[model samples]
Target: MSLHELRLLPWTTPEGNPCYLSADSDHSALSRLADDLEAAQLDSGAQVLAGARAVLADPGAGERAVRFALTRAVESLDDALRVAVSRGRRIPARHR
Candidate 1:
């Protein structure tokens, strides 16, 4: 399939490569699954951000606590950015 026909899936392969879906329609089962996963990833990122902010605002938060929050925030940010890129690629050229 041509690059424009391929959809960038929400998850990566075990080798850390981007995954693509080549369904004729976006309503395909795999495409729906990817949509659901992307929504979940965004939701999780929001939750992580809220928790990280709480940790940062706490004067008593220990080094470990801060580090853990930072780590989770980073992971969530990565997932969110991946989702954004994937969605951006799917938008029609005219829309951009």
Candidate 2:
């Protein structure tokens, strides 16, 4: 959860250049965050893939995971949007 919250911090600085967090939190934390992101991406992708395969096997099971993943993604996005808006940052309209 700390790692996820760290990623919510901007990757680019105000000058639009990529930078890292203080040395106290270096690559290890970033790597863990990256791993988490990768896992989420894989989970979302696999959810779709499994759903597709389930369409041939047990339609209900496949539909359930896919719908759950989509719902999670939407909720995560909504939370991010609310945070950004509250912080006075520019958020995309779709997220609003």
Candidate 3:
């Protein structure tokens, strides 16, 4: 689901990790689904938002979509960190 459809309150933790609170704990499956979504290769903020919106709108949707969204989020964050490190030449100098 797009962030808008999911009504996600986007905020970062002290460590700069994006996180959200899900009140719909009745379905334990949603938790894992969220994790899977965070692991996907959603390389752009816009795509993540769009995908999240689509998932959140379908109340009857399977947990897979949630998983996909979570995957994307995580992948995006990982990409960001890699970029930051690369820009600073933090990796072994020889690797560059």
Best-matching candidate per lDDT? 1
Compared with the true structure, the alpha-carbon lDDT of candidate 1 equals 0.89
lDDT of 2 by residue, 1-96 (tens): 233233333334688664433333435776556446545654655565554555546545665666765666565554444344323322334565
lDDT of each model, Cα atoms only? 0.89, 0.48, 0.54
Q: Give candidate 1's total backbone clashes.
A: 0
Encode model 3's per-residue lDDT on 15-70: one tens digit a residue: 98655544444235754554344333334755776777788888977888888887
Which ten contiguous residues of candidate 3 have the minimum total lDDT?
Answer: 1-10
In the order shown, the candidates' Cα RMSDs to the true structure are 1.8, 11.7, 16.2
lDDT of 2: 0.48
- Model 2: per-residue Cα lDDT at residue 59: 49
**TM-score of model number 1:** 0.92
Q: How accurate is candidate 3 locally (lDDT)?
A: 0.54
The superposed Cα distance between candidate 3 and the true structure at residue 60, in angstroms, equals 2.8
Global fold similarity of model 2 (TM-score) = 0.30
Candidates in order, TM-scores: namely 0.92, 0.30, 0.36
